[model samples]
Target: MRPKITFFDTKPYDKEIYKPLAEKMGFDVRFVFYHLTEDNILLAQDADVVVIFVNDILNEKVINKLHSYGVKLIALRCAGFNNVDIKAAKDKIKVVRVPAYSPSAIAEHTVALMLSLNRKIHRAYFRTRDANFSLNGLMGYNLNGKTAGVIGTGKIGKSLIKILKGFEMDVLAYDPFPDNKLAESLGYQYTDLDTLFQKSDVISLNCPLTRETKWLIDKDAIDMMKEGVMIINTGRGKLIKTTDLIEGLKAGKVSAAGLDVYEEENEFFFEDLSDQVLEDDVLARLLTFNNVIVTSHQAFFTKEAFMNIANTTLNNIKDFCEGKELKNEVKI
Candidate 1:
């Protein structure tokens, strides 16, 4: 019998992409549209492997339940694994992930968000459609000479720096382990977080969410930033405290915010809730601010990215099934 793989939180795109790949690779695949929660963990009982996306919940309780059902591997089709309980699955089931599907996809989206917010392109499009061509409230500053503070020098951050360099923008980056050589070669400098906050005209968060990085931007961090600074987050939502960001917007401390992620986004993201009333008060409040552009966490949504994710994820599962070395295994 072929090894069965069950994919949770499956979307139409996932079925379109993964179905063909799994058939060619000779694996039995199941697509579950809803997220993987403890309540629905039984759906994975017959699966030899379980595939999950960013929003799937795999807590200790759920991991234990999967182990009881004989699931051997947990394959994450995306890069981030913060939602999974790595410690709980360490002994029971091996876990692997597609680490770098398409860093450029996210980096490009980051710049897109910045440009849209800065030039008020979103507003301009709507106004023109309504036959109102006045440029009132549409003035925007040039980005050529502005300083951009980029947090975390990972692949995505480095890609963003390259794009910013193309725009002739001065770049300031902050990372716990700074690469002086990379910085010098990229025409950027690594600095401390406080300095980055105070000096930057634009602050972009591209760091991973860890114990140290959770709530990295809060009241105090916002207080240190330059007045009217633009903030962009393509990283984890928890990187910035949403309530503090709302307050910053209210006080005009932050001129604009371009967010592809939100702290409490799991409840609403990747789902169509237009027909239903939004009950998330913090998220609802954010939508009211004209200066804020809240996307549905689509920074990594591109054709190239989706292809890379599907191929890499399938290879991860194949390696585990064939008893080959799990090169992408997430070890505690």
Candidate 2:
């Protein structure tokens, strides 16, 4: 019998993409539309591997439950395994993820958010549609010769730096483990967080959410940034404290914000809650700001990225089942 793989928090697009890929790979996987909560852990029973996404709840309890159910491997379709309890799964189950599906896809989306927010494209589009073509408030500054500070010099960060260089923007990047050689080759400078915040005209968060990185952008960080600085986050949502960001926006410390993820997005994103009242006041308040643009965590939603995700996830499962080396395995 083919190995059974259970997928949690699957969307329509996930099914549309994974079904054909899995079929071609001669594998069978079950798709669960809802998130993997403790209540639905039974759904993973009898499966050799469990596939999950960012929103799934895989705490110690869930990891213990999966171990009881004989699930040997946990395959994450995307990068950032902060949702999983690696320590709890250690010695009981293995974890792997697609660390770099399409860095360019995410990088391009980051640029799109920056351009739309800075150039006021979102506001301009609505005004033109309403026959109100006033350029009174659509004024935007030139990106050329401005400084861009990028956090987390990973593949996506590197890609973003290359694009910023094309715009003639001087780039300052901060990473816990700095690759000075790569920075030199990319024509960017590696700086401390304080200097990056104090000097940059635009700041972008492209790092993973870890204990050290959680709430990396808060009141203190904002206070150090340049006045009227543009902030962009295409990374994990919790990187910025949303309430603090709101305060910065209100005080005009942050001129604009472009977010593809939110600190509390799991309940709101990937769903059609149009007819219902949004009880999350923080998210609702964010939508009210013309200077703020929040996307539905779609930075990695390109066709190439999706195909690569599917192929990598399936390959991870194949590798686990065949007892091969797990190149993408996440170690505790």
Candidate 3:
């Protein structure tokens, strides 16, 4: 019998991409529109593998239930695993993820957000739609000579640095594991967080959400930044504290913000909520700011990235079924 795989939190795009691939890969795949939560944990009762996205709640209880139901593998389609309880699933069930699908997809989206925020594209587009062609309040700074500070020197960060360099911006990066050679080759500097925060005209968060990096951009960090600095986040949302960011925007310490993720976005994103009133006070308040741009976590939604995710994920399950070493397995 083919290995049984149950995919949760599936959208139309996910089904469009994965269903055809599953047939080619010879796996018995099932797609569920609902997310994998504590209440829906038993949905994967008869499956050998459980596939999930970022929004799925895979805490200790959920993982324990999956284990009890004979689910051997927990596969994540996205790179971030902060939502999963890796420690709890350590011995009971193996976890794997597509560490990277397309670094350029996210890297390009990061630059897109920066350019949109800097050039006031969103505001200008809306103004033009209203038949107003005036350029008032649309002033934008040149990125050619300005400094860009990038957090995290991973694949996506490196890709972003290349693009920033192409725009002739002086780049400063901060990471615990620094690559001096890459920085030198790319004509960028790797500096301490304080120095990067103080000097950068535009700051971009491209790091993972870890214990040390959670709320990395709180009040104190904002205070260290340059006045009227542009902030862009394409990484994990909790990397910044929403309340602190609001305070910064109100005080004019941060001139603009572009967010592709939110700390409390699991309940809101990936769904059509246009008809419903937004009950999230912080999110509603954020929309009131003209200088802020909040996207529904679509930085990695490119076709190339989705294809890579589908291919890698199915192959990961295939390798497990064939008793091969799980190269993408998450180690606790």
Candidate 4:
């Protein structure tokens, strides 16, 4: 019998890319549209492997249920796995992830947000559509000479640095263990966090979410940032404190914010909430600000990234089932 796999939180595109790959890998794949929760653990009963997304909860309760059903592996299609209980699955099941799909997809989207916010592109397009020939508040600054700060010199951060270099911007980076070779080669310099905060005209957060990174941008950090500084977050939502961010926006400490992720986004993101009132008050308030641009966590939605994510996830399952050593296996 072929090994069975169940994919949760699937959109049309996920089915489009993963179904074909699953067939090629000889797994009887089942795609479920809803997120997997404690109550929905039974959905994995007939499958040997369960694949989930960031929005799905892979807590101990769900892990135990999957174990009872004989599921041996859990595959995460995305990079971040804070939603997954690693300790719970360490002994019972092998956990893996598609660590890097396409860093360019996210890095490019970060710049897209900055350009739109800085140039008022959305507003300009709206006015052009209405035949208004005025450019009142559509002024934008030149990125060529400004200092840009990038936190975390990972694959995505490194890719963003290349783009910043092309723009002739002065780039500074902050990482605990700095990539000195990449910095030297790319003409970027590594600096301390305080200096990055004080001197940078634009601050971009691309770091992973860990105990040390949670709320890294708080009231005190905001105070240290240059006034009217533009901030961008394409990585994790928990890195920025929502309340403190609001204070920064209010006081012009944060001149503008371009967010592809939000701290309280789990409830609203990846789902259509247009008809209902937003349950999260802070998120609703952020939406009201003209200087803020919020995307539905779509930084990794490009065709290249989507295909790589689907193929990598399905391949991980196939390799596991075939008794082959997995390349992207996560060791808890």
What TM-score would each prediction reach against the true structure? 0.99, 0.98, 0.99, 0.97
**What TM-score quantifies how close candidate 1 is to the native fold?**
0.99
Per-residue lDDT of 238 in model 3 = 98
lDDT of 3 at 214: 99
Q: Return the number of clashes found in candidate 3.
A: 0
lDDT score for candidate 3 against the true structure: 0.95
Clash totals, every prediction: 0, 0, 0, 0
lDDT of 3 by residue, 1-332 (tens): 49899999999989999999998888898999999998877789999999999999899999989999999999999999999999999999999999999999999999999999899999999999999999999999999999999999899999999999999999999999999999989999999999999999999999999999999999999999999998999999899999999999999999999999999999999999999999999999999999999999999999899999999999889888888999999997
Candidate 4: tens digits of C-alpha lDDT, residues 212-323: 9999999998899899999999999999998999989998889899999998787779998789988888998998888899999999999999989988988888788789
Per-residue lDDT for 1-332 in model 1, tens only? 47899999998999999999998999999999999998898899999999999899899999999999999999999889999999999889999999898999999999999999999999999899999999999999999999999999899999999999999999999999898999999899999999999999999999999999999999999999999999999999999999999999999999999999999888899999999999999999999988999999999999999999999999999888889999999998
Give lDDT tens digits, candidate 2, residues 1-332: 47888889998999999888887777887899999999989999989889999999799999999999989999999998999999999999999999999999999999999999999999999999999999989999999999999999899999999999999999999998888998888789999999999999999999999999999999999999999999999999999999999999999999999999999998988888999999999999999999999999999999999999999999988888788999999996
Hey, what RMSD does candidate 2 come out at? 0.9
Q: Candidate 4: misplaced stretches above 4 Å?
A: none
Cα error of candidate 2 at position 11, Å:
1.5
Whole-model Cα lDDT of every candidate shown, in order: 0.94, 0.94, 0.95, 0.91
Collision pairs in model 3? none
Model 3 TM-score is 0.99
| Pick by TM-score: 1 or 4, better one | 1
Which parts of model 2 are misplaced by more than 4 Å? none
